[model samples]
Every structure is written in structure tokens, then in C-alpha cells.
Target: MQPSEGSRIVVGVDGSPSSHAALRWADRYARGVGGAVEAVSVWDTPSSRGWSGPAIDPDFDLGQARELFERELHEVFPDGLPDGLTRHLVEGDPSEVLIRASEGAEMLVVGRRGRGGFARAVLGSVSQRCAQHAACPVVVIRQQDDPAR
Candidate 1:
């Protein structure tokens, strides 16, 4: 089925500095365009814990994922979500969640959550994947040198 489009700008947030930057960017752009911002935090459990076998980490709780997402959002916007802004906690791979969320979005914003070394060599997997496959335009925010960030 086709995804429903809306005047919402979807941003993939992970609480990282880059992700926070992406959120700020999305908010600014959305304000300019008169669009609403949808801040999304995507997470996934260990594959080893899937139906194939018992979870390797017994302490892992699916509920914590939602809490973390909210905490991150609050940390960035301690005043609480701004007007026309909403939060979403999705359970799945980051790329998949963001891409799917973008289907009905005016645009998709993501941070280059790149880890130096091997992970970096992959070109920031989540951002790269979303940019390549998002149904709408994708903005990949990179880490910057800002004390406020």
C-alpha cells in the first residue's frame, strides 16, 4: 500500500550530537516551510535475541527503548517538544525506521552517526541508507564543532 503523505518533516534522532544537530536543522527548515516536525528515535534489539534463540542480554527491556527515546528528546529540548513537533519511538533498525517514516513526510532528516574507523568507512550507514532510499528528500547532518551542540 502507498504511504500517506503529510506536511510533516521526519527527523531520525539518536541523542548523538549529530542527531541533535539534525533535529535543530529540521526544526528550522520546518518553521520556514510551515511544516510540522516529527522527531523519530529508532532502536533495535540484538539479533541473537530473536526467535532463533534466547536473548544474550537478560537485562534488556523493550520498554527501556521508549524511555531512552524520550530522554534523548528532552535532553535536546528540555523545554519539551516545541509547537508543531511530535515524538515517535520506533523499534527496528534505524535505517529501516527512518526510511519507512519518510514515506509520508515532506522530507527526512538524519545525522551521519558515523563511528570512526571501520564504522566510519561504511559512510555512516544509517544516514547513507536513508539518503539513498528515502521516499522523500533526505538531509544528512554531520557532526560539527559547536559547544552549544
Candidate 2:
């Protein structure tokens, strides 16, 4: 059966290995359920977060974020993006952006951890927040340890 128009799966992508895994899982799940996929990538300037760090160009950061978002999508869908896949590159907090995107979605998918500084965390802050506050059900995908790594 073909997915109805309301069947949308929102997934967060942050250029992390776990995020890639989440994207893959979201796509597969969407296909199985006849749903569409919406991939969201978020970026924020240090000043926006009130960080007292050295001045940085916001344009440059946005560009890098866009690049990473595109790269991640290409890496995941090397052959081509699926028919119902949509991409969004927004500038804001990752958690807030993803949560907002989750509205009206069938489900929200995210990586257990992202490209954050905390290495030992079982769940990244963004994913944790989304799981807690998103309007839709959330699925967190854990990154598999590669034997080669």
C-alpha cells in the first residue's frame, strides 16, 4: 500500500556517524510504512548561544553547515535521494529545530549521539531534548561500532 500524504518521518542529521545511521533507519522505516522522509540539519552561531568565544563569521559557519548537510545526504543516498525525501537546512538550536520539524510528522528519528564534545554520553543533548519534547513519537538510533575502527 502506498503511504498517505500524512505519513512523514522527520529525521535529524548532524554529520555524525550515528546521525547517518539514523537517516538510513528513517529511510528504511519510511519505505516500509509508505511514508516520506524529511531530513533536518540545524546550525547556530556561537553568539546566538551567548558563547563568550572569539568572534567568528556567521556566513562562514552557515556555509560549513550547509556543506556538511549536503555531504551527509550524499553519503547516505549515494545513488540518489528517494522520491519522497525532503531536506531542510535551518539556523537554530538543533533540538528546537528538530522538535518543530516533528510537528505533524508520523515519527521523529535521531541519532543517540551527535557531533558534540561529550564523548561518553549515551544520548546527545539534542536527541535527548527532542525525544522529550517533540510533538511526534521519537526513535533514537545507536551508532554501531565498526570492527575496522
Candidate 3:
């Protein structure tokens, strides 16, 4: 069953366990609804974001982001990718990029927390911002082993 136009499930992937769970959940939901999944992975140079962290080459960071995105997808779909799955590797803040992608989408899905330093927080900054500002409804998937569960 081909999904109707505009029935897209946009999901954010950050190479984190919770993101992987979100990806799997998005795929399953898309399949059940005959919708398509748009997986968005965002990256930015530390300097660009004024993080003051160790300086790194933008090219290398981009390559690493791409590799991580592909690895996560492969891990989630070991056999093969789903028929209606599409991937996007964008350069920007994760929340901002994902919010932009959420426009005209059926839903936006993200993980409760990512690789950010705030691991102990219930929700990561990206996920929180996405839930607050995305153009569509948002689903925040928690990690499988989250103690809050």
C-alpha cells in the first residue's frame, strides 16, 4: 500500500541508542501507516557553533557524521532498508534542521537524549527544542534501558 502524498514520518538520528530506537519506531509506524520515513542526521563544526571544544577539520567532521549516520541505519536495518526510507545529512543544529524537515510532515520523531554531555537529563536539548518548535506533532522515544521507564 503506497502512502498518500504528504504522509511522511520525519525522524532525527544522532548515532545514539535512543536515536536508534526512534529510527526503529519510526520505521514500524511508517510501515503500519503506509507512510514514508525521512531520516535526518545533522552535523556542525564545533567552531561554527562556538562550542570552544577541540578544533577539528570541517571536512573530517562531515565525513564522520555521514559514516555514523550510515552505520546507525545499517545497524537498525541489518537485513535491508525499508522500501520507503529516505536519508538526509544536513549541516546545522540538530533541532533546527529537524524542525525544518518537519514542515509538511505527518510527524517528527526524536530520541529523549543524544550524545550530548547532558546524558543524565531526562530529555536532551535537541529533543526538547524539536518537541517545542517542530512544525508537526513530535514523538520522543526513550532509550530501551532508561531507568525512568
Candidate 4:
């Protein structure tokens, strides 16, 4: 079936190795599916308040975040990324942003874990939430092994 304009694949990146892999995978899938890829990164302003603080900064630096998202695209695709590829920086909880974006996406791709220090045996909160609530299929790419495997 032909993918709708809103059916572009969405990948979440946090400048981490696993997220890089997700970008690469999403790019390849987009090409094969004759669709575009969305390179998305949700940046929140660091809050001074305790755990109940808002997820994103009211004055989030969108420009810098966009640059980082584009840089990540280049790193994953190297020579170039597919045409129609776009990047976005939304301010909010990562899970909420991704889930909302996924409403129009053919699929959502994310790393098994994010910047949080945790074992691969579990998915990051964002990834877990996306997998549970996304409108489309979700792919969680695990980090590469340390070569001892």
C-alpha cells in the first residue's frame, strides 16, 4: 500500500549510539518503503525543581536542537540522507512527543535505552511508553555488543 504523506517513518534520537542506529535503520526503511524519514529529538530545559517539574523548557533552544538533529542525520547516512527527510525539535516529554508524532507515521523507531544509565534488559521510559501507546508499530534497536559476545 502507498504510504500517506503523514506516514513517514519517525525516529527518535538523543545523540546516543543506539539512537544513531535507529536513525540509520529508519533511513534505510524509508528508502525501501518509498517514504520519508523524520529525525526527531525532544529537548527539555533542565529544571531546577524536583521530579515533578515540566519536561521541556519554556524557552527551549530550538535552533541548536535542530542542528544536533541534522548532524545526527549526517552521521547516520554519511554521504547523504534520503530526499524529503526532515527534522523536528518539540518541547515536551519524549514519550508524548514521539507518540503524538507517530499518529501520522508509518512506524516509530527508537533506541532500547536512552541517556539514562540502565541495563539493556529494559527499555527506556520513552521507548517503553512509545511501544505501548504509539499509533503504529515501534522498533527498538538495542545497542551493539562490546565484542566479547
Candidate 5:
């Protein structure tokens, strides 16, 4: 009476409105299909802020990324994650990160546009890249009514 590992739906979350919408949609879809949803957020130290000294610098807090990811999860699910839902915090490019996370997943869900605005006019870079490279089907959720359409 439980979904197999292959039925897992991997969603890319970046704390953006669109990404939040994708998470909600994934939750609904997973419920309908009796599957599980795993929320994934990717973060990396900017090149501009790369290591300037030893990896263990008291001045630097490595937990920042995990904190951010948890904060986003809370924002999306203030009531807490659905029963059996999972979460992950990774470090890497969004596209590469989501693509890798989708391995063996039944589906990959993403928002139409993330934090990047005009830069992702057609399709958000991460969504586009995942659609092109993901091993499973990709579902792009619209965050808002596109008045232009």
C-alpha cells in the first residue's frame, strides 16, 4: 500500500514563488498517485566568495545553506511536510543538481520561472535544462497567470 522508490517525485525548490508553486503541485499530484515527494534545494558559495582561507574558518558558518533550505521548506509547508515527504539540501548548479536528483525518479517538477526574472523569459534556465537532461518526465508549474498569454 506504499509507493515504491521508483514512484518518487523529485522537486527543485529555490525559495522562489514559482518553486513554491511547484512544490504544492507536486504534493497534490503525489497524493493522487500514491507517491512520495522529495523537495530538493541546491546552493553553493558564490565564486566571488570562494574560500579565502582554511576550510574551517570560525568566521564562516557552514550551516547557513542548510538553514536556508530549512527556512524555505518551512515557508512552503508552514504546517510541516506531508506525511512521508523528504527533503534534501545539495551544493551545485541548480540545473545540474536537479538533473542528478531526478535519477530513478518517476518525475521531476519545477516552476516556470525561479528567482531569475527576465533572464528566463522563455523557460527558466533550471527548468529548461532539466527538461532537456532529466531522465524522467518534467512537469513545469506556472506560478502566476501570464497576462501576456
Candidate 6:
């Protein structure tokens, strides 16, 4: 679909380096198309179900986490951002939210793998799902390789 003035470029952010790259790429594309940018972060608190694992604290403090997410977005958005820029912190699955938001967007962007180690070539669940099901075109941003690493 052709990008219009009200068209949106949706991006999924997890506050990771790869996610940040996706946000930057989305920002540039949105600017070039004279469209809006939506930076969405999905936060789903784990439930204390009948599962055996590490002891989970039901009352984990998420205030700091939200603050960090906002701060990181600001940092990624250098040279200032457009007024159309929006940050959404929804409580749901990342892939679901991304697909729903992309219904009306011109395009969607996400990281190949977010905050996870996939020694070889493997796409993260969220990115993979988005790519397979999103209504709009999707771009998978790869994390930059550090020469020092």
C-alpha cells in the first residue's frame, strides 16, 4: 500500500540493541514517507500459575523497566523526532499486538532476534510470527556486528 500522510510505520521494541536498530530504521522510513511512527513495547507479566521453575515474584517492580524503555527510545531518536511519533506500552503478546497494529499501518519493522542468543541463523518467535502474518510489509532489522567482538 502507498504510504500517506496518516499512514503509520509500526515497530516492535524490546529495548534491545536489535530492537533499537529497528526503531531507527522505522524512523527514517517514516520520515521519508511523511508518515507517522509507532514504537510499541509489549509487557506481559508472567502469571503465578501451577508451573515448576524459579520462584517468581508476583509483585515485581515494573516501574523501572518502563522508565528504561522510554529512555532508550528517546536515545534512539536522535536529531529529534516528529510530532507523529507515538509510544505504546500494552500488556499483551508481542506478535499479536504487532499484527493488530499493523492492520492499519503501511509497514512494520522488527528485530530478527531480540535479547536472545541464537548461535546460528534463526529468527526470534515474535519476528518470525510477524513476518508470517502481518498484513503489511515487514522488515527484520539485524543487529550490527561489532568489529571488536
TM-score of each: 0.78, 0.85, 0.86, 0.77, 0.79, 0.79
Best-to-worst order by lDDT is 3, 2, 5, 4, 6, 1
User: In model 6, how large is the Cα lDDT of residue 72?
Assistant: 81
Tens-place lDDT per residue, model 1, 97-127, is: 8899999787899877632247435655888
Arrange candidates by TM-score, highest first: which order?
Answer: 3, 2, 6, 5, 1, 4
Q: Model 1: which residue pairs collide?
A: none
Best by lDDT: 3
Give the 10-residue window scoring lowest on summed lDDT in candidate 1.
114-123
Q: Tens-digit lDDT track for model 3 on 75-146?
A: 888999999899999998678899999999989999887877753254558888888899989999988733
Q: Is candidate 2 or candidate 6 better by lDDT?
A: 2
Computed on alpha carbons, the lDDT of every model, listed in order, comes to: 0.77, 0.85, 0.86, 0.79, 0.80, 0.78
Error of 5 at 65 (Å): 1.9
Q: Candidate 5 regions off by >4 Å? A: 1-6, 48-62, 117-124, 145-149
Q: Write the per-residue lDDT of candidate 6 for residues 1-149, one digit (tens) a residue.
A: 56688678999998888888888888778888888889998765455324534565534525655786788877786557657889887767678999998997889999877763462236448888899999999998877831211
lDDT of 4 at 42: 86
Model 5, residue 112: C-alpha shift (Å): 1.3
Q: Mind giving the per-residue lDDT tens digits that candidate 2 earns over 8-112? A: 999999998888888989888888888889999988887665565666899988998889888889988899988889999999878889999999888999988
Off by over 4 Å in 4: 1-6, 48-60, 117-124, 145-149
* Candidate 5 lDDT tens digits, 64-98: 76787788877777987787689888776788999
Candidate 3, overall lDDT?
Answer: 0.86
Over 23-53, each residue of candidate 4 has an lDDT whose tens digit, in order, gives 7778777877778888889876556335655
Comparing 3 with 4 on TM-score, the higher-scoring candidate is: 3
Q: Give the 10-residue window scoring lowest on summed lDDT in candidate 2.
A: 140-149
